[model samples]
Target chain A: MSRPAPRVVEFFSGPDDLSDQQREILRKMGERFPELTVDELPLDSDKARERGIPLAPGLVIDGVILGVGSVVSAGRIRRYLQPQQE
Target chain B: MTEAPKRIYLDHAATTPALPEVVDAMLPFLREEFANPSSIHAAGRAARQAVNLARSQVAGALGCPPEQIVFTSGGTESNVLALLGAAFAREESGGKGHIVTSAIEHPAVLGACRFLESRGHRVTHVRPNAQVCIEADAIIEAFAADTFLVSLMLVNNEVGTIQPVAEVARAARERGILTHCDGVQAVGKMPVNVESLGVDLLSFTGHKFGGPKGTGALFVREGTELRPIAAGGKQERGLRGGTENVAGIAGFGKACELAARDLEGNIDKVTRLRHRLIKLLDTASPGRLNGDPEQTVPHVANVCLVYVDALLLMLNLSQRGICISVGSACASGKLEPSYVLRAAGMSDFASFTSVRFSIGPSNTEDEVDEVVEQAAEMSALLRKVRTPEEIGQCDENCPCLWEERVA
Candidate 1:
């Protein structure tokens, strides 16, 4: 059986201005969850507005807000998505 | 599956990406204008003219006469030449051989002073007050009968604290001590008038202001005599020796010109963004700013988180796509906490938690907002793993002894 694809929504107002390490981690995250669907949210996107996104370049996973800031690795996103599991 | 986009760069103080305009201006000199400025040939004259034009441009940006400028390899060389040359010259003239500098100076100035100490010169380092501002009167009080030079930076790199160069210069002048202002971090970020600063020598770097690296200039007031540290050629009016870096100098000139024209607008925009970042960080993260907020240059902000480790924070932030600095970029590779923080009376823990976010002209409000959001997330994540108790127990004597064991 195959794992269900993770629905990933990334809100970035700017392009790749992040560090090299950060870009690498994001790439690794994509590799880890091959079926993950990434969506770019505009600064004024309705989803971002309804979810009360405080800033741009924020992340949301499975309808839960991942908080504002730069996301470095897939693990960091996973941690936010599944905070209950250590 | 799609990949997440890369992180953003917010650490302009550490260094800057070379501006495309500067690169374009430098290309011709690098390829075609590669001739010795000293040679009397046509190519040499071209190089000479380029060097002279750059000197005038730098001088103009600083509001000084062109003849007062002397180009050097970079800020380090300019600083060393200023401190060592001035002190040694005074010594040779049978005047006071003592020098006074700030406790929070960059290593370039501090290290030179240390070297002078070994050579039998007296040196005094004046500490800053609670606000991280060096008191001119305190420096004045520290002066000795033999004090010949006083070196202070216009802006503190780590904390972004602006010193009173004019007041300090006036104080130093009253006592006949020649003053040298390290304007490397000040010149392009603010309006710098050497005549108003009243300093005998001022050092500035090109890379800090969107120019090519390895190109810097020192402003020497007329009639202030100093012997050359490097002796060989008659380059730089016999003060510095070596064939001129024509391309680098030309780029430096263009960078200065651009900086002068855009100084105010750039400051206003970056300052607003910096304030927004500070406010966001203050609200989201458990930290406080490290220096006097109003007394600093607009582009730099130093935030100190109470319980978080700065290196860990930097690592975490880097993981998130935000590029910033832990402290002075030049001093970051060293495992030690910042000497500047220690001098400012920050505790070892506070010093360890301090990170410098130096903005530049190219940064925008949106980017600053993103940085704030990401930084808050990272801070929250780090705080969870390291409890306050665990953080308190962290010290040089901790049994974990990871750093020592590795060493």
Candidate 2:
């Protein structure tokens, strides 16, 4: 049996100013757990508000708020996903 | 197990650790000497003498006569009494009067202006220039025939930019307008002579200069009459009436004497720390200083770390055993961007990203190095989530400037 990939969502407060960075973060993450899924959304969307996002540049991994108001580094995210890959 | 990081205090502008000498001076008043200064008994007389001696010590520091000093609770109360007491007395004599003040003043002054407005008196709040220094000429220009008072800070608390106090006082004096200087930040740090500054009233507090908290005073120039703000027995010359904080006042007096002693070579020491922080912050954030670099005091360095939220940075630094603040620690529990930066005409991004790193006389070069190294690390990690080079430039209409977004 195969395990499900942890859903990753990155939310930015205003405009999607960090789209390029998210792409870079995703590409780096893909190198490790290629099956991991990532979603980029504007915090203005109802989806982010439904999750009770506290600050901009928020990260939600598998419905758990990993961090807000800062970027949880890509290397750390890779390490976070490695166990799920196993 | 790892060792806990050594704590480094970089928020002296907020409050300093009370000096041991000051604490020792206050111990006697706090304990055995429980008599009120106003009482006529023997212990009371001793208390009165202590209060009088503190007043003289404070007066000697400010270069004013002892009778001119009216001790109050702290800086905020001193400022409130100065603004309201003077304005009300003037208004009672001649119909309601108007006031001219800067927009970037501490909440104490701004809140008092609101109170003055509620009582039907008008006030014009002038904004600072790009450098965050309130212009004396601009304040003078805003003065109307009905403007009877101009309340300006000697040193802006957030940015530590010394205002054009003497020049503005001279100009206001020419027009017979009373000038009130909020000298809270300048009194113990620098040479503060009320006569030389040419201001009719000035405010100072002890905690800001390493004394006990809840101790402050106002310098009311002779012949400058102010109606009493607090109604009580004729303590503080009937201006601010309440049983005095005997211990705190004694500590404040000691703090003043110590400040005067330290003033000889203190600026050079504090300035060295400030310059070191500013110079090294360049490699950390590559952002500019928030206020006028040349016109600022030696004790503060309000640096902007672009795209980094100041609140988040402050939290990270706190966890690392490094204490810093965004703007006024008075507004703690509220995580809004630096309004002083906004008032100084910076972008919301700049305002939100700037952290005030205020050094004190006791801070060392090693501490500055550690702070900059920590700041560089945190800011680098915080900025990783942003794509500033591509899509970070924002305008007023930019959605990124939105104060409210996620529910």
Error of 1 at B93 (Å): 1.4
Residue pairs in steric clash, candidate 2?
none
Query: Please, what is the TM-score per model?
Result: 0.79, 0.82
Task: Please give the distance, in angstroms, between residue B83's alpha carbon in candidate 1 and its true position after superposition.
Answer: 0.6
For every candidate, the chain B TM-score is: 0.93, 0.93
Report the error of model 1 at residue B11, Å: 1.5
The DockQ score of candidate 2 comes to 0.08
Alpha carbon lDDT at A30, candidate 1: 69
- TM-score of predicted model 2? 0.82
Runs in model 1 lying further than 4 Å from the true structure: A1-86, B1-7, B328-334, B393-407
DockQ of all candidates, in order? 0.03, 0.08
